[model samples]
Target: MSGTIAFGLFAVVFVTSALSGVFGMAGGLILLWFLLLALPATTAIVVHGVIQLCANGSRAWFSRHYIDWRIVAFIASGGALAALGLALIDYTPNTAVVSLLIGLMPVLVWIPKAWFRFDASRPHHALSCGVVAGGLTIAAGVSGPTIDLFFIRTQMDRRQVVATKAAVQVISHSIKIVFYLHAALVLSKGQWGMVLLAIPFAILGTRSGNAILRRLTDANFRYWTRWIVTAIGVFYFLQGLWMVT
Candidate 1:
């Protein structure tokens, strides 16, 4: 990649990772956009997956006690199945289709999660959510909104929601990365260097996000998640259109 592209990727990884800390899941999707522009789709998916694995793993561990493992299992199973299928297929999603889904996901889940007050008390149908999240994450580098909706419906406490989501993503992304590695997607030296450099910034962003997280109210976090997911969905929709055009 050119120096300009390298710088762009670094900037994206750093900024988005920080955003995820504050917003719960948008950071990965934001990074996905930059990567799509900066690298090949397959390369972008794996590289972003690896970076997110590190960033979210740390977040999961930092708030280890707060995780809801049941949800993690559901999401992971779906993710694993999806990743396996992705490795075998070669279909590109219709950008317009994805864009519409992205726009609707927030409207469908966020409004309910935020306004209706769905907490952790509801039964967690982990396998169902996991399968959906896993498949989507494999097809799209960031599918946090899909999984976030599942959690939102449950309305767990802020910490539980954030920490559990991180844990779930870690498992989901880890599976995707493993599939990519086994498939032998090529990475240039420049690409590797840029990805490595971005790791530290991603870390810094997560730390800053965690600190900022302490000051947020439950309502604020919900709103932030809603806004970020909606924004990312719109972005993907537009990106798909650009690709087809």
Candidate 2:
């Protein structure tokens, strides 16, 4: 990677981490898009997983008090199973397909409660969330939107939702890195260094966003999350369509 692009990536890591810290969504979607610009589809997905692992790891720790262990365990079990199945297939990501999947994912949050309900607190629902979200994470490089659908309507407050999602992503991202580790071997040592250098920024940004999260009312938090993700999804969907044409 060029020094200029490397520097830009670090900046993105910080900014998007901060964004995710606040809403616990959208940031990964944006970060994956940026990575895809500079790397191949599989390589970009691997890099994104590594970076997001850091971001979500710290976020989960920051909100550890609110994490629902039962929910995490259930979802993680499903996610692991899903990852194993995908790994056996030797899945390869396609950029346009990733964009389209991510773009369509935001629609989940808009579904009416009467039409379909998802609550992570329910064991069955949580397991289903894990399978769908884990598969999406590997196939599309980001599953924040699909994950949100399970948590958003739950009785859990914003902090609970953010913390639990972070923990889930941390686990899911680990599987993603291992699944695509070979593709990531193409990066030069210097490029890997650049990727690692983004970590501190990711941590700092997470801290900054957490500070803001403390101030948001549950109502405001959900309201903003929905709109931000929808806006991003529209952009990604358009980008995907353009790529196809």
Best by lDDT: 2
Best candidate (score: TM-score): 2
lDDT (10s digit) by residue, model 2, range 218-239 = 9999999999999999999999
Off by over 4 Å in 1: 84-107, 110-124, 182-184
Off by over 4 Å in 2: none
TM-scores for every predicted model: 0.85, 0.98
- Per-candidate Cα lDDT values, in order, are 0.72, 0.93
lDDT per residue (tens digit) for residues 157-229 in model 1: 7788889989988988887777656422488676687788878888777887877887899888887788767
